[model samples]
Target: MAPGITTVLDVRTPAARRQLAKTTVDLFRNLLLLLFIVRYSRVALTYLYGYGPIASAKMGYAALRKSLYRIFLSLPGVRGKVQAEIKQTLEELEKKLVPSGPGITRYTALPASGWGPEQVRAELEKLHEMKHTRWEDGRVSGAVYHGGKELQDLQMEAFGRFGVANPIHPDVFPGVRKMEAEVVAMVLGMFNAPADAAGVSTSGGSESIIMAVLSAREKARIERRVTKPEIILPETAHTAFRKAAAYFKITVHYVPCPGPTYKASLSHVSRLINSNTILLVGSAPNFPHGIIDDIPGLSRLALRRNIPLHVDCCLGSFLVPFLERAGYDTEPFDFRVKGVTSISCDTHKYGFAPKGNSTLLYRSAALRKYQYFISPDWSGGVYASPGIAGSRPGALIAGCWASMMSVGEAGYITSCHQIVGAAKKMAEGLRSRDTLRNDLRILGKPLVSVVAFTSDTLDIYNIADAMSGKGWHLNALQSPAAIHVAVTLPIVPVVDELLNDLEACVEEEREKQRQAVVEGKPKAKKGDAAALYGVAGALPDKTIVEDLAAGFLDCLYKA
Candidate 1:
């Protein structure tokens, strides 16, 4: 007990001092041992799990699962049985896709001689007959927007009038140029853009998105002298942005969407921004869940940071801009927001136009000009094109213009009402179910035409398959797994049918699961979608998924 220690230790008690000393030493030794083990284990596991036998085992498991499925189909009598079933299914699908047989009207090669007008008309009729899925009946979603016979007739007449027109040469096709300009002007006005706002028509939504990205990248390079550029977007943004990143060599920083809301987390987005970030993207109503992001906040952030903000209104299209005017509740997400530099809207989607039409607008003409491709030193004279494609189809442009003109402002307002009204009704019906209400939940407060739902107590993919069996094609989503339906004019007419089918499918699945439990049978493993998505979610090395995706694409082209 020196001056510092005093009687605190009670050193006089030899047994107590001995026990305390031993305890202190043991605790220190254990702490050091834990640190050493943790440090070494990380390094060992990195190498062990990264390659060699352990990695090989995981691959083997995946291959075995795939092979087992194949083997099940290959069993002697089973092979014939399964092949017959598959053949029948394929035949049915082909019948649906193409209703006419080869004898009906063949166009295998170019005609030795051009057909006359009446012959062309007859050939067109036969081609039309071969189509099934009457999208005009509203059987399809987000396709064939305006199905009125009057509009179709008008579009057909307009197309015939300008069938040979090309906007590539303004001198030769002044009318085509004027129509394209007017279409862009109308869209700009619809979005509440300033007089200075300008745009160019594109082939479709993907081109519009790509053009916007290209403009942003060029602006960053020229204005900020940024050689290496990057863009920040929500994970919910369209895959087109990923394509843009790959094509333009721009790095993409993806921020996670917030839970329940399914919108981009503003805080995380702000945190990810750096000097290299040239563009920030927010979707007016993202496709998967149809949840609009906090565009105003994103715009303000862009304004404060002096970065470009792009709002993707592609899926939302005409529907979003007119939501408020149509007497529906919606958040502000357009050029009216101070920081929005550009927007992409699909004239083909809710705009009620034919396919292959979209508009990419900018805050100023200078911004739009950057999207143009020009080669002044070309040997074949100066070359220029406003978008990716040259010699564009004038008939498609004519059809788009006619649709817009016929629908006008009031028509769009009315369409929005019907579509959104139907969607809300469906959402309400789903929300009222006890089993589905408790186990399944909507992804967000969907204010648009799409409603997505996922289940906590069942495999949503199974429900998707069930819906498919009922002859309804709903989109299947992953990464927390859900399914969504984009309500359209056709869906509006048959929403009650959809809801009834959903209820029956859910009940049937619940009962099947209950029986499996009672009979002591192992629950059925995940179906095709779950197995595919499960592999995608579990793989940390993304290259494996890339290979899988590539293989899937290759399968599509196979005979």
Candidate 2:
């Protein structure tokens, strides 16, 4: 043997050997554990934090799921059965909504001779009488904001005076231009915008949002040389932003909102920012939850990053700015936030203007100029338009101006107080219920006039369908299935009735679900609402959803 060789292996006590064996095993196990983790880290990271190449893999899985569903639905028997069921359901719904008559007589081809104004007006009145849902009673949420007869009369009068006028011919219709400018000026004053701040009226909220996005995109491209512009928005931000992204060919990154509050996670937002980030968006009060983002924090981020910040106050409109003066607690989400570059507000929603009017406001004239579409080399001379539309209806602008003047600041404050107070009462009543208190939870701390509720135990969509049966038209939300009521002046008078109805509906749904479980009936897997949302929320291939949405839109025009 060699001189340094030892006899056998070094011996140790029993406890020491056991410890050595354990350590050896642990060392081997740890190596294996690390290998396993390294292998699955991509998946875990994607599932938990939505990061890395695994994100693409998850998207592929989603696409596969959607494709499988589509393929399954395309089987002969499956397609026929599903189509028949859909047809029956749609027929039932149409029967309930449409009046008893030959269904909507379409004038496929215009008459050789035009009907006179009186005849046309008479036909329009007849068409209006055939609708079932009386939105004027405020049965619908966020549809008809102000239904007072006085406002209607004022709008009609204003329309009659300016129906023939067009803002395009400024010299001939100087009054129209003046009124438009004044409307923009008045809205700017309402938000306390700086002297350099400017804006233009658009057809509605979507157009306003699109114009703002366009401005941000162009500004980033020209100023910062950002080629692949990306806009960061809260998940609760309006779907309009997605539409803008698609239309403008910009990238959109959604940041999730935190717990019970449903406000954007500023920490995650800070992490998401890259060199290509052109704009950061915060909603004053988002449509789904009616919760304002942490605008102060988002503004600070924008300031530090030197990115444009756009606040969507479309749904908030007249309510948010006036909440503080109306004796309700509110947050700072307006021009007061130094980094805010633009805002979109709908005059039609809470401003009580006629439908088809909204404002796109910018922090400065330099920013506003980016949104203008100008064609210098056009054959039809140098052409420029302030917003998306070339020839907009002056009648709507006139009506908007009239509505604003009629509902002065004091009137809005009073309306805000009533609506906000009623919404709070309804929320309180829901919270007080022992049955719903635990299972059902409000999405956020709503300071304005909207309240959204979801449930952990029961299907909230089923509750929504039940509420629909009771003639309460509440909005259905997804991601996590929930429903919301946008309280209006009319809802103020019937707040108790609404809460009572909601309680009854929830209880009835719970009973139905319990009976279904006891009888072993499949518990109504997921009704039409859930099925429709399932397809929408699941599909990574948005084109498939787009096709479905297009089909649905086409159905809206069915003869």
Candidate 3:
């Protein structure tokens, strides 16, 4: 035996060495096979458990459809037609979004010398005067939440006071720091948060939601050692949650919010929960249909499963909290509900705060700590941030604080009464009006400011186009082919106008369909909204839509 040979195994003979090598190779192969089976088995089981057999089958069918659609798109003629259509659509989008004229000067490059303040103001006035959606007159839905001229003036004054303030350096801007803390505290109190609850202001609703999702992910990783975290979201939950999951490298299990309630399915959410699930999400009056999920039921599930629940009240904002006080129906969705670890609310929407102001509330300070990013070792020295942003604009914080202070509880209750009252009235008109009822039907029972409706006899997108022709900007929805009017303060007095316009659009679309049939045509020509949504609905794979959307974003930056 050699000096390094083991006494337990004699490998002096060629036959012995060959047998040992074969045994070692076989052992490794078996291990690899076992690992492959274990990994795939877990994946298969997760799918079967998260989505039931029917839903899993549907998912498989959708994947197959996507593949087939991609193959079809790859064909020479089909590819050419698709590319041509997309190019045409993108051109139309650019024309609509990017204004261009002989008189319009493109500011593509900075001037050699900065212009005077008066010159810049004149240019801004010119920009503001350009043709655009007249949201001030209340035709638009949920874009601007005006709090009267007085409130606007006050917000402007506050902004001027803190023009260059940044909340990152609290010592330098103590007043802004105080205002930020008070704003969070006030909002937490509005949401019925406990004494131990904590919150941080963020740039907007999207950032607030992202922070909440990040907090849950961090909490799960630190406490439960969950390497592969997952989240269960209602189908109608804000898209920011999906964006957050994508950013954080977490898996998302979207439970369907099926009609007619258009709320998350508690049963499906329950089934989706596993040891790896980090958080559960519910929307308070989701954006599309304005239907609140069953939060109490979701809370119970969250408690039983020992997972955190985050209620997205960004759209709900000040209105949901004041609903009962305003003498309107409401649902349970706040920190008061057990197992709800976090909530996101936008002061900009119904709170009448300026843009770029939102808050994320945690059930306790410990939970909120997870969202904080602190670095102890850095060349620049130790640094910490409460949320995603590093140096936040204190002017927006001041504006938010001023807006909230100017609009006291009584004021919010009154606004809530007016807004929700108008929404319910619109919903009632849509349901009871003979012409509107004949063609259109409201989706879900909307208790919030958004009233969504779809038509069974006519194309809803066509009706949206007709509404646009009448200067009413309504939000178009998919999956059910619907349109929604998010009733704001501006829209309160115009509720009757909205109902009348919607009725006329429905009738007009019906007449067009009738005329098309009389002319021996398959259907009428598609309008802008009809054409865009038609293309979107027809595609099984949304790569084309994605490209068009990217093009639209590009148009936004075009001079």
Model 1: per-residue lDDT, tens digit, 1-559?
Answer: 3677655666679988898999999999999999999978754553344334555476567777767756665679976875575455445545444436556554567899998999999878877775455554445555556646788798889889888988898898888888899999999998889889999999999999999999999999999998878888898899899999999999887777867799997876786677778999999899889999999999988999999999999989999999998899999988899899999999988887788899999999999988989999999899999889989988888899999999999999998999999999989988996756866789989999989999888778878877767767778887668988899877888888888888888887787778888888757456555665666676544444564455555544433
Alpha-carbon runs more than 4 Å astray in model 3:
1-10
> Looking at model 1, how many pairs of residues clash?
0
Local distance difference test, each candidate: 0.83, 0.84, 0.92
Q: Estimate each model's TM-score.
A: 0.79, 0.85, 0.97
Best by lDDT: 3
lDDT of 2 by residue, 1-559 (tens): 7899885633477876887789899999999999999868743553345333565577668778778878877789987886776666567555554434665567768889999999999989987786455565656666678747898899999999999888877888888899999999999988889989999999899999999999999999999898888888899999899999999898887788867789988876886677778899999899999999999999999999999999999999999989999999999988989999999999998899999999989999999999988999999899988878888799999999999999989988988888889889978988997766866799889988889999888888888877777777889898777889898877777777777778887788788888888989856566556666666676554545555555566566655
What's model 2's TM-score? 0.85
Q: Tens-digit lDDT track for model 3 on 207-290?
A: 999999899999999999999999999888989999999999999999999988999999999999999999999999899899
Off by over 4 Å in 1: 1-139, 525-528, 541-559
Of the candidates numbered 2 and 3, which has the greater lDDT value?
Answer: 3
lDDT of 1 at 461: 81
Instruction: Output the worst ten-in-a-row residue range by lDDT, candidate 1.
Output: 43-52
What is the C-alpha local distance difference test score of candidate 2?
0.84
How far is 271's C-alpha from truth in model 2 (Å)? 1.5
